[model samples]
Target: MSLRRRILILVAVVCVLAGVAGLSFLRAADRAEQRGRTQAGGPEIARGGLSLTPGEDGPRIVFRNMAWGPNRDELASVPAAAPEGARTASGVSCLRFHSAGGTGICLQAVKGGVQDGYRAVVLDARLREVSAHRLAGIPTRARVSPGGLRVAWTVFVGGDSYAGTNFSTRTSVLDLGTGRLDASLEDFTILKDGKEFRNADVNFWGVTFVADERTFYATMATGGRTHLVRGNLAARSVTVLRENVECPSLSPDGKRLVFKKRVEGLPAEAPWRLHALDLTSGTETPLAEERSVDDQVVWRDDRTVVYSLPGDFGADLYAVPADGSGAPARLMASALAPAFLG
Candidate 1:
């Protein structure tokens, strides 16, 4: 072959290989960008090539843009509005905003560890701390009512281990509008099967308020069974509604309740399945998320539910269809105990 022809053929082969490598690199970059856009809620620009960008406005990213932060307008359809200046308190374990007012309530551990006590901190719309109550247990959950007039929380106490059998919880409610605090639900009168019942072992947690703000639902455990109990703040009374229901979360419309039902024969560790119960008809519909959900569930809207699971990095939040129609989708990485701020 002529030397010039040989040289031209070699150069052509090199160009083809370079083109292929460039195409491969571009494809990989596109895949990475796609993943980032979906996972982080980051922006995506598609000009000649795809690029990942920051979200212009959404949920006002906080905690160094942590994944568990609620997105913008996430609870717009729901009755509540996100509390302003909610993220000002550092090391918050659980938080919730009222539906209509600027009041925000959160539980922050003194430190990141469970041995340290928690602080139930109230923040105004400007994110300034208004009041704080020193609590004696590890922070577990915090919730605010639709009108921001009421606050509820649960903390784990006297636990040998975080997941140990000896662990107990203390649940409390505060009527912010009236400045009345029910320091503990254990003092309330318990009604089981329409009769007054008293037991020292009775425990309550996971309180979800209804529209009336006077009535709420919570999980009560006694006699080795967990029951869903409806309570009235005015009367200081609780009546068991159904058995095997833990961590009841009321739907936005107040017509249904979502809770975790303990499954038998799983192992030493109790496995719970998410179930939705009709408050009127007493029919229970199991949610599509089959994994063992140990945390209290929250309603994103009327049609969707969100919860958290422990992950390698941190706690992660997930969303599942309320009607058991779809698989769970990861909503935030390293987020647990999510509350909607509309």
Candidate 2:
């Protein structure tokens, strides 16, 4: 063929490919829009005046709503007794959230003109933003102290998934009363195996504060194993408690910890089994949940623990006995990161 004819043919092919790409993009956008509308048979969600404080309605469960609708991804609440009922969605949205004593730690995404960013926000009793700190990367776990005086959050700074072998996390703690912020828990002194430990690859995540507000527990990953560490904010130090524990959630009585243990023979993507560890006896009892869970669980009560698993919409919450006796039961659909407020 002539050179001019060949050039014309190439131009025609490029235009055809561009047209197809544009059409596909439009279709995808339309499908996303449809997700904003309520689907039949899905849980009802409505905008309302949601408060973190316990009131006449009694105890309520606040979580990140994952149901497909206008209020999807927003912080929502439902009566703890009727978790499957209609949900009241607050205007604020968070990727991960936890609350205690009328205070909330919300890790959220911020859209920018060029790139998206993440931040940790503190919410008051009225679910209003008290303060916000810009994060370095994607938010993962968030927690607020029992007295509503402190907050902590974790973000992925390097690798993506915690299930993988290589990843980095940045955990931060903030004092709401004093306006003091610990940007990274790595700055604190670490004691492992009865000696001061220091490593360049150490990463910390999944912080759960104790009732005393000075003590906290978190997952510290260094070398190849994960350890449950007890942290002291006043002392600016952490002591390694045990190994193979990730995302430890302390019981109300402070005598036990509910954490995800990596069980042998399971796939790396789903390697964790919920386990309860007795702090006094060092006994670990695997919970009744057969499926793998990759979440930082919350204590619904002294006896029951709640965690999230993958669902059709996004994620769903489930509750299981902490003593490894009863079977796991579905608590609510399309919910993640639950915090029981009373």
Candidate 3:
């Protein structure tokens, strides 16, 4: 054997080993940063009524129709030194009505690492929280009709099993005063190849109920892209409405929908945005054109649309016109889902 040849082979082997080690190191670093993003708190909070609810315990309803902005003194008294004031310089991320005698309960994030955890506060008609409770799983994003006859939220069981957590979004209904589930969140079936694909984890969360309480809509994901599923409360069945969407936010009149669509061939920051869909026309329009716009929007009226925007200290809240006319206004900062109270 030649010593020179043996030395050259050794050098080649060392070079290959170093390259492999370097690649492994780079991959590990990348995974570390990605894992750090546990959805504990991110743009999702800001996109939804980020500043609506007091605590980050879970789902929150926005008090959008409480006459006007939140009263600082009244809010301070109930939550007492909450880092982000309820609909302060920032806005909230959720909107829902109180069930009957129960005060309006809204969703908010308490802190970081709270994926399915949020705080629910009892708010009076004046938009003041009478009390608060810590919610575990993501509360079904829901809305109550003007008549206050029905309350609806989505439900999913097997979806929770992901990420070592059982996170499911189910649609639940409640009567006004009783405050009990009028009808538990049922399941959805997929008619594929003439067979029923009954999956417990339907990935259903966002829900919108019409005034009639018989028909509502939600969002579901199939084959990586998302779709809208309209389910009739009476029949308990769902049909695909739209595709390539993430979350669908229904309008107050139930005539229009604002949602986040998966913009393919675009940058990652553009996966979600503010989009409006006409139920009767099936026409989609881009309203708030922001690369970073996220869903969880609530309709203050037929014209005003409110969603959360993330900011320093925490996520903030922002609002824009649903008619696609006015510029986005920052209603408050450091908040999540803002539910309305009329």
All candidates: CA RMSD in angstroms? Answer: 10.6, 7.3, 15.0
Best by TM-score: 2
What value does the lDDT take at residue 308 in candidate 2? 93
Give the Cα-based TM-score of candidate 3 against the true structure.
0.57
Which lDDT tens digits does candidate 3 get at residues 113-226?
A: 835456555445445555555554555465544454555554333453211224555455555455544344445455433455555445665666666767767776544446
Error of 1 at 247 (Å): 0.5
47-154: candidate 2 lDDT, tens digit per residue? 788888875889999999998777889999899999998888887999988888889888899987788888888988898889989999888888888888999998
Ranking by TM-score: 2, 1, 3
Which candidate leads the pack in lDDT?
Answer: 2
TM per prediction: 0.72, 0.88, 0.57
Residue 202's lDDT in candidate 2: 94
Candidate 3: lDDT over CA atoms?
0.53
lDDT of 3 at 133: 53
Off by over 4 Å in 3: 1-103, 107-136, 139-142, 153-171, 175-197, 267-270
Cα TM-score of candidate 2: 0.88
